[model samples]
Target chain A: MLSESDLGALAITLKLALLTTLILLLLGTPLAWWMARSRWRFKFLLEAVVALPLVLPPTVLGFYLLVALGPHGPVGGLMESLGGRSLAFTFTGLVIGSVFYSMPFVVQPLQNAFTAVGRRPLEVAATLRASPLDRFFTVAIPLARPGFFTAAVLGFAHTVGEFGVVLMIGGNIPGETQVVSIAIYDHVEGLEYVHAHWLSGGLLLMSFLMLIAVYALNRRFSVVQP
Target chain B: MTIEARFRIDRDDFSLDVDLSVPSRGITALFGPSGCGKTTLLRAIAGLEYHHDGFLKVGDRTWQDSDCFVPPYRRPLGYVFQEASLFAHLTVRRNLEYGIKRVPAAERKVSLQQAIELLGIGHLLERRPARLSGGERQRVAIARSLAVSPRLLLMDEPLAALDVNRKQEILPYIESLHNDLDIPVIYVSHSPDEVARLADHLVLLEAGRVTASGAISDMLTRLDLPLAHGSDAEALIEATVAGHDEAYHLTHLDFTGGRFTVVRKELPVGSAVRLRVAARDVSLTLEWQSGTSILNIFPAIVDEVIADGEARMTVRLMVGGVPMLARITRKSASVLGLKAGKLVYAQAKSVALLS
Candidate 1:
C-alpha cells in the first residue's frame, strides 16, 4: 500500500496528465490537419520540429525548457513583465513539459488519419453546397474519429508515465510536482522496497490495460470501417 | 438558350483550349478518345478546375469571367464523377439528402421523393455505400445530384468505371432524366454508343480541340467525318409506329422515306422511335424485286458515291429527303453504273431499334 505522501504524489500525477492531454488535444488537431494537407516543401521542417521530443533525450529537453521558463529567459521575462512569476517550479510548468514530451504521440496518429480521409469526400461535399468549414466539421471530423481515439489514448498514457522531464523541471516537491515515478524513486533510494514495489506494480498494470483497450478498439474500428 | 464556355489550360505535358455554345436543353455529349481533354472541359464547366483562364455562361448566369469567379459550392450545378464517391459513413438516404439540405427552400425545384423514384433506389435507403453494388451506388449518386435542383448538370464519364452489365442497368435511368427534368446536361463520354443513345447535340473533341459540333444524326453520317467511314457506320432514322398486323406478328413503321415492316413490338400507334441502319447491311438495286426474301425496300435517288477502301464504295442516297448509306464493292458499283441523280432501290437487310 502507498503511504499518505505517496497517494498525494499519485493524485498530482493524474491531475497533471489529464490537464496535459486536454491541452495537447486542443492544440494538435489543427496543426496535424495542416501538416496532412499542406503541399509546401518547408512543411517537413515543422514536422521535424514536432517530432524532436520523440528522439530527444528527456533531460536535454528538460534543461532547455527550464532555461526558457526561468526568470532571466525570454518567455519567463515576458511573463514577469505581464505580472506573472517565473513558471519554472509550478504545476503549470510541469504540464508544459509533459505536453511537449507527449506531443508526437498525439499528433502522428491524427496526421495519418487526416491524410487517409483524402480529397474526394471534401470535393463531393463542396458540390453538394457545403462550405469549407462545413465540410471540415461534417465530413473530415467524423471520418477521423479513430485517429482522435488513438491520439487521446496515446497522449494520456505517455503523459502519465513521464519521469525525467518532470524531474528536471519540477524536482520532487511533495503534493505540488512530485509524481508517482519520482515518489517510487525516493522510496527505493531510501531503502523502502515494499513501497516502491506497490507503486511500480500499479503503474505497470494501468499502462498495460490502457494499451490493450486501445488496441482492441483500434481493431474494431478498422473492421467496422474498412 | 445555350451554355457557352471558353477555357485555356496550360500544363507541363498537355493543354486544353476550346470555345463551345451548346444547347441549354436535353443532353450535349462531349465525345472524344482518352486523354483528349473531355473530362477537363467538364470540370471547367463545374468550376472544379480553377487554375485556368476561362469564361462560362449557362443560360443567363455568368459562372466565371475575367473579373469574377464563383466557387463550386455557390454554383447552381450538379457534377457526377466517374466514381460514385458516396460518403462511406452515411446511409444511402442520408447521402441523398446531403445536397437537398444545402439548397434554400425557394430554390428547391426537385423533391427528394421525385429523385428517389426516378432512380428506383428506395430499397437502398437504409444501407451504407460499402454494401451497395456498383450500379446501385451510381444510381444513388445521380439521385443525390438531382435532389440539389441544379440549373445545369455535368457528368464526367459516369459509366466509365462500371462493367457492361452495370452500365446497361444505369443507362435507362440516365435516359429518363432528359424526359422527366428540364435541366440541361453536359455529358462526357468516350463510347460512341452512349453518345448515340443519349445526346441531342454532339461535340467531337480531338487533341484538346473541337473537331465537329452538330446534331447526333448529322454528325454520325457526315461524309467528311470518320464516323461514317468505319465498319460499324450506320445512319439514324426517326420513325413512328403506323400500324400492327397482329395476325402475322408484323409491325409497320412510318418514316419520311417509306413504310418499314418489322417484327412486331409492344408499342402503341404514333409512338416515336429511333432506327439504326448499318451501311454494310444496305444493298443498292437498279430495280425493285418482288420475289425476294428481303421485306423492306425504298425507292431512292443516288446523291453521291465516294470510295471507302481499295475495293469498296459508299453510296449516299436520298429517299424522300432522308439520307441513307449503302456500302458496295467498286466492281458492283461500276457494273450497275450507280451515279448521282440515278434512281435506285435500297434494300435494307436489317435495322436495329435504338429506343
Candidate 2:
C-alpha cells in the first residue's frame, strides 16, 4: 500500500497536469494556427523557437525558468511589485515550469493537424459566407479535432511524468509542490522498493493505456475521412 | 442589368488582362484553354483572388474598385469550386444550411427547400459528404451555393472533376437552375460541348485577353476565332418544339433557319430548347438532294470560306438570320466554286437537342 504522502502527491500531480493542459490549449491554439497559416519569409525563425524546448534537456529548460522566476528576475520581480511574492518555490512556479517543458508536446501536434486541414476547406467556408472567426470555430477547429485530442493527452501525460523541471522549481514541498514523479524518486532513494514499484508500475500502465486509446480512436476517425 | 469587370494581374509566369461587360442573365461562359486564365478571372469576380489593379461591378453594386474591395464572404454571390468542396464534418443538410444561416432572413431570395429541390438533393439530407457519390456531392454543392440566395453565381469548372457518367447526370440539374432561377451565372469551362449547349453569351479568352465576346450563336461561327476551326466547333440554335409525329416517332423543332425533325423527345410542345449542330455533321451542296437520308435541309448563302486543317476547308453559311459552319474538303470547295455569296443547301446529319 502507498503512504498518505504518496496519495497526496498523486492528487497534486493530477491537479497540476489538468491546469497545465488547459492553459496550453488556450495559448497553443492560436499560436499553432499562426504557425500553420503564416506565409512570412522569416516565419521559420519562430518555428525554430517553438521547437527549441523539444530538443533541449529538461534541466536546461528548468534552469532558465528558475532564474527568470526568481525574486530578482523579470517575472518574479513584476509579481513582487504587484504586492505578491516571487513564485520560485510555489505550486504556481511548478505550473509555469511544466508549461514550458510540455509546450512542444501540446503545440506541435496542433500545428500538424491545422496544416493538414489545408486552405481548401477554409476557402469553401469563406465562399459559404462564414467570417474569419466563424470559420475558425466551425471549420478549422472541428477539422483539427484529432490534433487537439493528441495534444491534450500528450500535454497532460508529459506534465504528470515530468521530474527535472519540477525538482528544479518546486523544491519537493510534500503536500503542495511535490508530485508523483518526485515521490517515486524519494521512495527509490530510501530503498523502499515496494512504494517505487507501485507508483512506477501505475504510471507505466496509465501512459500505455492512454496511448492505446488514442491510436484506437484515431484509426476509427481516419476510416471515416474521405 | 449587366456585369462590368476589368482586371489586370501580373505574376512571374502568367498575366491576365481583361475588360468585359456581359448581360446579367443566363449563362455567360468564359471559354479558353486550361492555362488561359479563365479560372483566375472567375476567382477574381468571387473575390477569392484579389487583383490590385482591378474594377468590378455586378448589377449596380461595385464589388471592387480603386478604394474598396469586398471580401468573398461579404459579397452577394455564390461560388462552386471545380471539386465539390463540401465540408466533410457536416451532413448534407447542414452543409446546405451553412451559407443560408449566415444570410439575413429578409435578404434570402432562394429558400433552402427550393435549392434542395432544384438540385434534386432532397433525399441526401442526413448523409455526410464522404458518403456521397461524385454526382451527388456536386448536386449538394450546387444546392449549398443556391441556399445563400446570391445575386450572381460563379462556377469554376464545376464538372471538370466528374467522370463522364457523373457529368451527364449533373448537367441537367444545372440547366434546371438556369431555367428555374433568375440569378445570372458565370460558368468557367474549357469543354466546347458544355459551352455550346449551355452558354447564351460567350467570352473567348486567349492568352489572358478577351479575343471576342458576343452572343453564343455569333461566337461559335466567327471564322477567325479558334473556336470555329477546332474539331469540336459547333453552332448553337434556339428552337421551340413545334409538334410531335407519333407515326414516325419524331419531334419537329422550329428554329430561325428551318424546321428540324429528330428522334422523339419528352419535352412538351412549344417549349424553348437549345440545339447543337456540329460542323463535321453538316455537308454543303449546290443543290438540295431529294434522295438524301438527312432530316434537316436549309437553303443558305456562303458567308465566308477559309482553309481548315490539312485538306479540309470551313465554310460559314447564313440560314435565315442564323450562322452555321460546314467542314467540307477544299477539293469540293473548288469544284463547286464555293465562295462568299454562293448559294448552297446545308444537309444536317444530326441535330442534338441540348435542353
Per TM-score, the best of the predicted structures is 2
- What does chain B score (TM) in every candidate? 0.95, 0.97
**On a 0 to 100 scale, what is the lDDT of residue B144 in model 1?**
93
Predicted structure 2: lDDT? 0.92
Please give, for residues B1-355, the per-residue lDDT of candidate 1 as tens digits.
8999999888888888899999999899999999999998888888777954899998899999998889999999998989999988889999999999999999999999999999999999999888899999999999999999999999989999999999999998998898899999999999988887888889999988999998887788778888888898888888999999989999999999998889998889998877888999999899898988898899999988889989998888888888888899999999999989999999999988767
Candidate 1's TM-score: 0.94
lDDT of each: 0.90, 0.92
Please give the DockQ score of every candidate, comma-separated.
0.67, 0.79
Clashing pairs in 2: none
In model 2, how large is the Cα lDDT of residue B86?
Answer: 91
The worst-scoring run of ten residues by lDDT in candidate 1 chain B lies at B43-52
**Model 2 over residues B208-238: C-alpha lDDT tens digits?**
9999999999999999898899898878889
* Lowest lDDT block of 10, candidate 2 chain B: B191-200
TM-score of each: 0.94, 0.97
Q: What's the count of clashing pairs in each model shown?
A: 0, 0
